[model samples]
Target: MARSSRSSAPEPTQGRFRRILGKTITYGLILALLVALGVAVAVAAAVRNLPSFEELRRSPTAQTIRLRDVNGTVIVSIGPNYGRWLKVSETPAVMRDAMVAVEDRRFRYHFGVDPIGLARSVKVAFERRGTGRRLQGASTISQQLARNVFLSNNYSMARKAREAILAMALEWKFSKDEILELYLNKVYFGGGSYGVDAASRTFFGHGAEELSLSEAAIIAGLVKAPSRYSPTADAQAAVGRANVVLDVMVDAGVITPAQRASAAPAEVRLASEPNQNSARYFTDWAIPQLDALIDESVEPLDVWTTLDLDMQRTATASIQSNTPEGAQAALVALDRDGAVRAMVGGRDYVSSNYNRATKAERQPGSAWKLFVYMAALESGYKVDDEVVDEPVTINGWTPRNSNGRFSGTIDLRTAFAYSVNTVAAKLGDSIGYSTVANMARRFGITSELNTQPSMVLGTADVRVIDLTAAFAAVSAGGKSIQPYGITKVSTAEGRTLYERAPPPQNILVDAWVAAGITDLLQTAVNTGTGRAAQIGRPVAGKTGTTSSNKDGWFLGFSSGLTTGVWMGRDDARPVTGLQGGAAPARAFADFMRVAVANRPVEEFTTQVELPQWQLESDEEAYYGDPSLEAQFVDENGQPIELDPAQPGPQPRDTPGDGPGPDTADKPRLDRRWIDEVTGSGGDNGNRATGQRGSGQGGP
Candidate 1:
């Protein structure tokens, strides 16, 4: 009886224990369901803002403006330069296999988020918790694409949830091949490049369609850390990373061990590093102008610029070699039609991208006098007419010459050649400062002019490009021009988008006025402050030096090129003994000597013959003397009377007199060899047309 009772008691105890176990199981199941529901809600909330499939598919890639020289050589790329967009069928089998093996071994089986990879990554994190190693991520190719394209790389649970949700959405909306294509086409490579084709071109000098197995492996390995494995950054590290990719490919059964062995040596040959980055100054200036031509809907563009690569190199070297220490120098050279051929913004673009050539506004000093002299010439003043160089005052502002003591009563040519401030001030005052400012505007000087008497002495700030264009107009025999850099803009497939229109041959000044100013410029270069700029040719130029030598400038035209150089401290601090005739003129001569070596020497137009005027009486009339009137004689020495009411020797050619036939013969550069080498069928791969502007270097 006692044994039976003990057994019954144990049965009841066992039954009680079973009831407690059942309750524990029910609570655990309820808690697990609630947690799962919470997680589902959080994921749903995180992904509510996700982009739709069509929006994601149509997401814009970083479009680049690839700048090319006149000869079709690439100058530089602006923005993240992407290569050709490729499809899965177009991708090489070897490249695909290598990329899959290295980036995501289970890329084919993953439904978007790879649970196996996540589990393994978790195990590793726990194993190395105290090792001070960075926690690794197990992002599938789809997850990576989602993060790269749609999500930021914030390390948070919400980001991870969104990434996973987006990955799944991508898998649902796109086929595996489409996902792979997007990933390969959108992946980031180093050196401001993106995508397989761009990366291949950047690293191997070819496209992804032609990638070798080893090259494919090398590029595939860059996904881990692009900068770390970039061949340009470190060749040895790149080789090691590529070998690792080959080993992974072998393990994944994509490539055999034999194939891996052959590619293990990583006999990868990288393309030569681009040495044309020195042209960034030109690219920087030309890129903003590109937006005005094409809209965002257009494909990536190949911009054919007006730059002469050889001339650009020479200008850069000359500027770098001639620029003074602790000071910056900028140079802008234009063709006769005002096409920018060469520009150097500063001593070193790496140190500063300030773009002094196009952006810096510095006082042009005597270079500003080009307008004053043109005004004088347009007002019927002869180049040989006499002007007193004594100190002059206008509007209670007294102006002194740079030498502080000017020669008494010198011819206009002598006064101009010497850059005498007193004569320039007097000329501006007599012609009405407004007239001088208007003259500058007519010649394409876009900067605001002070219109004060000091403006005649170049107190106004101006861009080097504008000043250079102004000089180019004078060299073009008074035809106005707008400075331009791009000649053609087209897509990679050779569809032309924007082509620079031929410059209008608008006559800004009379031919006689241009000739008279040219005569003065020639005298300056021959026997005056700009004598150092003599390049053994008939050069016509002017020199400008601001007060205390804060700014120096040399502007001139020769061999059908108008170039301007400016040298000064960026802070406007004075540079010791920095006159326009010193470094700026020497640099101009140095650059021009080589830039125009092949071109035939061209001479300035003949100076217009003017009647000998009575200088004393003319001066009296210029000073507003009502009693005495100026007298003039014809070239035949016949006495003539001047009209006080009517100014200037003759009326300027009206707009109806279309360009007046002083146009020089435009020379087109022969690009037969360039076509043969580029296989561009004479269009330079961008279908560029109409040659470079009208005169000197072109095509």
Candidate 2:
């Protein structure tokens, strides 16, 4: 009775204090809870307000492609190893079912976040993962899409939270089927693949539509961790994953136990070489062209160019088979309009990133004589004009012929056809270095030409594209053209932001002048240094070699196509005893034969102004390396003339210099750079007077 009385009879001040303390504690707890709730809401709102999946997926560096042969065979898939996508219109039911069973058992029923799958995944995570991957993921198809398309390849709670929010948003915006499709299409299933369709064909000989249950299950198993369970990477691991998936499906009652037992792993037919790219180099080059012409917003555009599949295959085969064992080769083909049809960057592109055909800048050797002779021919010098091939000195440098024994007197055509370097240098001198440089520019050899007299002998580091365009110009009646790959670029709905259509150009050279030039080129293959480049068809072309046997090149053309081939190491190392006519010429012949195999045979005829095989000066003058006199010009050396009266069908204007954004200062490379560069002989033995707009090798 005393204890009850004491409890009830608390002093008024003490009781008031106790009551106030209790109320204050409760209020503080409530405030803290309210603040936490508000903070969580703010974070959810921020995540929801972030960029959408499509916006986050944009990348300027992602190489987009639309590659097709002339006959419309998609010889290569289009992408540069990141953020790739492909379609699957009709896929294997077994594959689809396996995906549903393995990735999300109730995929057909869920909105985006599968509550039951997430619960199951969470339950399994606490179980650990050593004995064949027990730890599971709450990632549904939508969550996986959020991760693959938007987030980076990282594992974190923050990332997972973002994935959950985005997945929810995606489910709200898109159908469940659409979410599944995007996830399947966007996922990368290891071994240089993206999308279920690409993965199916890569792992199995069949498409996604033809995948067996085992195959489908195997692919689905890759979803958890593609590299860890790559069938090609580790068959045992892949089998283990498949078994685990089968067990899970059976346990979940998605499949019968007998069906699970019946499922067996099939042989995964991997590519011969993991990096076996059918057209690696070609595809690499093609991506840049597409990106340059089209905007990122464009989609579903298939670019059909002049690529010849047969020719490309044949060229690759020839280079792979006939090269000097470890030596590499690249090949390129172009039509009259300078549209590249087929481009093999190397013997095997996947194994090597070296683009021998397009990126290499090799000394053209005698192949450069084409421009020198073109300059001479246009400078009123005839192909039959006599020139001295004997030891000639220019600017204190003596130039020797490739054979080391020069004919005392030979016609300019004979000298060029024979690949005589000294005589070609002399003609460059006699015709003025500006004339030769100018001719090279017009021919589209925009790689900086050297002002040295020996530059006429093809010492410049020009690419295969340059050679193709220059040769194509000769075949195109001397109409200047830039090589084009994409024919047209438009969206799936046919909205055209960029349509690849090159403006036509008139003849840059007289018909007779070009005919005479090609006449010599034909002779170069028929009875001269380029005899190795001869094909079954009537062809005209030239072979090029570089100093120290470092680079070998063959540039040739028939009426139907102009092609170029190069062979060398990526480090620019010398292939001693190798010449252009040996490997490169053979590659060119093989590629051209396949490229033009189906084309109607055509011939070069008189197209524009006729030529007058003018005479040469009868002066006993030095050709190379004497008095430092790099260039000698005829009286009338000037820029090419355009006939206003005989206007062409279309006039392709040069990239006009406008009120452009302020350009950065481009530092000049000094003249004696040859001595400092450690890559040439006595400053390249070059000393030609440079002309404006020639892109000549020197400052």
Candidate 3:
């Protein structure tokens, strides 16, 4: 009876074990079903936010804004580096092998996520628990592309789940090759480069299709740590990473042992450094104009500019070489039609982005004399007219020459060539300051001008580009010019975005007046303060030196080109002994030498004749008496005809009033005597011949 009871107890124990096993199996199945359902719901939610496959494929990447020179050579790329899109078939086989071997060996077999890799990563995480180190990522190529394109790089469980779900969607929608192609084109390779194409061009100076086996391995190795493995930043580490990629490729059977060995020691001739945008100043000045002309919706534009790269380089070198140490300088070169050829805003663009050429406004000094002299000529004054250069006062404002010594009576040509301040002031007062300011404005001087006598010597401030364009107008034969840099803008597909038409040539100044100024300016370059700017050609220019030498300028033009240069301390402090005739003029000459080396030497047009009626009208209109024209008559006193057909006198041998061959046979007149008697020069004692020195001097 006891044996029977023991056997029965064993049966009950077996029954209990069977019940426990059944419950355990039921709970396990329920847990598995719950996890699978949760995964399905998560995937569906993630997929709901994803874009359509076609939309994702058609989405535009960040395109580069390329600025090309007149010759279509790319001078600057202003946006992200997105190289030309390439297909998976277009990529080199070796690059594919290297990438797969190093980044994801199971890429070809996985459906977005690799179960084995994920399990291994989990095991590694468990083993490395409490080590305070991040666990390695187990993302496949599709998963990486999903993260790069659709998800942020956040180390959160939600982000990872979304990445996994999106990766699966990508796999379900595309083939392995398509996923690989997308992955290769979307990865960041650091240094502002995006995708394999840009990375190839940036690091190897070639295309992805042109990469060698070793080069392919090296670039592939950068997937893990691009900045850390940059060949440019650290060559040895890059080589070491490439070796690891080669070993992996060999183990993966993508390359043989001998091939790996051959590729391991292969020389990686990295491409040369990318062309830096050295013409940053010109680009900065030109971009605003470009933007204004083109619609904002038009993107990825190829801006064709008027920049002459050779001239731009020459201008940069000249400014750096001629500018005094610790002083800043700017230069702008323009064609006769006001197309900007070259511009250098400062000595070093990397150190400072202040574009002085278009933004900086400095006193032009004697460079402003061009407008004053133009006004005088338009008012019936001739180059040979003798004016009193002695000390004079206008409304209690005494004006003196730069040398602090006065010439008794100097011809208009001599006075201008020497940049005589007193002569300019007296002429400005006689012709009317309003007329001078109007002439200046007509010549494109946009800055406000004070009506004071000192304005004749350039007390007002003007931008270098405006001054350059003003001189360009003179070079273009009295036509108005709007300085422009971009000639045309188009898209990559040859679609015309913006085409710049030649602006109308509005005649601002009279042709005869412009010619007269040009003649006097030729003499200025021939023997005056602008002699340093002579380039063995017919150059017309002026030298301007401001008070305390704070601002120096050389505004000049040839028959076909015009250029202006300014030099000063950026802080507006004095540049010690610096003068326009010294540094600015030399820089102008140096830049012009290179700018016109390949062009023909064109002479200026013949001086135009000022009509008799025009001269009579100006004389009567300005002096308020037609008979006053006789006061400026020649020695014979026959109401000397001011003929533009006749050539002016040669430049004076000396700077001041001295005996020289007078071409016009004009008589010396103390214009101050006329001013005092007519109440024109100003309300002060205007001595025709006196040396009184007690006042603040002019520039």
Candidate 4:
């Protein structure tokens, strides 16, 4: 075949100039071909070295988190399933719709990266005349998965080039399902939780198995901008995102206009507090225990605990809401097996790592009476046994009641429930200070209990954590269990890293004897100083308001949990009108109500009472109501043994409603903040220590 008309017609112009021009054209064409080949080779090589794009294409970008009720019913979460996270595989229809709606419309048609999208983005940037080009990312699910799972925060051109290469590699390495799983596991949804697994539980309070369309939409929308679109952070933005996602789903033909219209913007329900079940409070108090348990050289352990999420929520809430002003609070919640489910050391965990629940010693005041009575019980004393509630003195320490007037004569139970200082002192004196201290230690009192008479009234300082251990013994039916935080811990790839068992010890008191004390604690709730704490259930607890009213405490227990609360000011300048049973109780009650709302109601395991006694002494003869007896006995109503104790949970009944347990302790560390070191009682936050010229509140 003769050349086409155009090829033949262009051969005319001749001579040396034509020959040189022809030669140059031929050379230019060759050079162009070579350049194109090089570009192709380089791009191909880069893609080959990158992630496996095919694996990423099938990776999951959208996931659901579900929070559930105790009965395993989904309550809330990021997506529709409530408290569950559903992988794309679990709900492909939703995932496909989400992918097409928000990401690449031609995902299946493209190899991980989309050159057409990039070119279009370049065109838009040129038109806009901006140096920094906005993204019109056409990365398929596979490419996104690759970047999310294994990429850097670097946004330079080099990083982008690397990301593209990695994307290809990921596609090659993982099957669609595997890539999707990695994608789902790596993306963030804000609210401080990492991974889809953690996000689901954090937002919806459930696992990955449950989710609804609405919930899924909410979570899926978070992928583009997790923090800004998070339901917890901006409900309006999240709703806007949900609407956009719905529209996209409809456009993609995944859902009909009617379905899109029917999709409602979900209401986000989030825990008021963050970082529950991390054992912030207990970590401080249990430091020694933890150090003893694990080797320190390799960062000790990456551990997990059997903490109940709901229970921990309540603990933090209680402390945050109820802690007295200027005070820092701390708390720990434990299972009967001695696992610390939740802990809060102070008001703001980020401000300081000091765990008030486990660190920072504070006076127990009347709260310590529980130990005195426990000591009395161990010595074979009956709760109803007569004790002179008169002037009690020891050396220079003359312990007196706030009222400075005693009830003349009272039973051990009566005094304990009332937190009568004089009576507690007498009981401790009779029991021997050494014996009482030893008993306290057995119940988990890690702090040194003073041997002085004032120690009987809880005068010696005790950390809230130490108090928790002592109380846990009471709840565990007299078994002395060491408190443990982690149950089991695993690596991101599911490799087991650590595990924990409950702290173990023998029975500190007879079952009946322990029950007897719990019984009296119930009375404290029914008609003692802790009456303010009663909330329509059998709550065995104690209310301790320090003499200065600076420190307030309410330590309580239920069949499901044991909680200790302390309220005081960071400056130690009394919380003014606030006290233990209020802020702590309110916060505690808030958490407990939600935590156990779906669970069956449970009761304490104590049951024993004392017979009404008629004292021969006139002072004893008029010991209140004869029918109102005191004593810790077995089911048969007799003192099992003189008791020993963890006085953390003393039930008190009084005239007024007050705080509940799980309260925050005073921010003792706050006062000493090196960043802003100062004295106590001054607004400027710096003053002379002894001049009484208003000093700084604390550091």
TM-score of each: 0.56, 0.54, 0.56, 0.47
* Per-residue accuracy of model 4 over 450-481 as CA lDDT, tens digit each: 68766776667888777877777887778886
> Model 4, which residues run further than 4 Å from truth?
1-304, 501-505, 608-699
Report the lDDT tens digits of candidate 1 across residue range 479-502: 887888899989888899888889
In Å, residue 274's CA in model 3 sits off its true spot by 9.8
lDDT to native, each model: 0.78, 0.66, 0.78, 0.59
RMSD of each: 21.0, 19.1, 20.0, 23.9
Segments in model 1 whose C-alpha atoms lie over 4 Å from true places: 1-60, 77-276, 296-298, 609-699
Residue 635 lDDT (model 1): 32
The order by descending lDDT is: 3, 1, 2, 4
In terms of lDDT, model 4 sits at 0.59
Q: For candidate 4, which ten residues in a row score worst on lDDT?
A: 690-699
Q: How far is candidate 1 from the true structure (C-alpha RMSD, Å)?
A: 21.0
lDDT tens digits by residue: candidate 2, 126-234: 5654556543566787777776666654555786777777776676666675666666666777655667777876777556766767777788899888756877645
What C-alpha lDDT, on a 0 to 100 scale, does residue 339 get in candidate 2? Answer: 73
Q: How do the residues 1-699 of candidate 3 rate in per-residue lDDT, one tens digit apiece?
A: 999887788887799999999999999999999998987776767667767756765665444578899889998887657776778889889988888888889988887889999999999999999997665769888878887676545566886877788887777767788888877777777555767888899888888889888888888988898756877656778899999999999899999998887885347787666434448889867765653675443257788999989889999999999999889999999987788889998887755556789888999988999999999988888765788778889998997777787766666767777788888999999999999999988888888888988899899999999998988888888899888888888888888888888878999878877877887787777767777999988898898888889999998987588999999998899986578889999999999988888778887653455666644545355445533433443343323344444343222222333365554343545464454233344322112112322221232
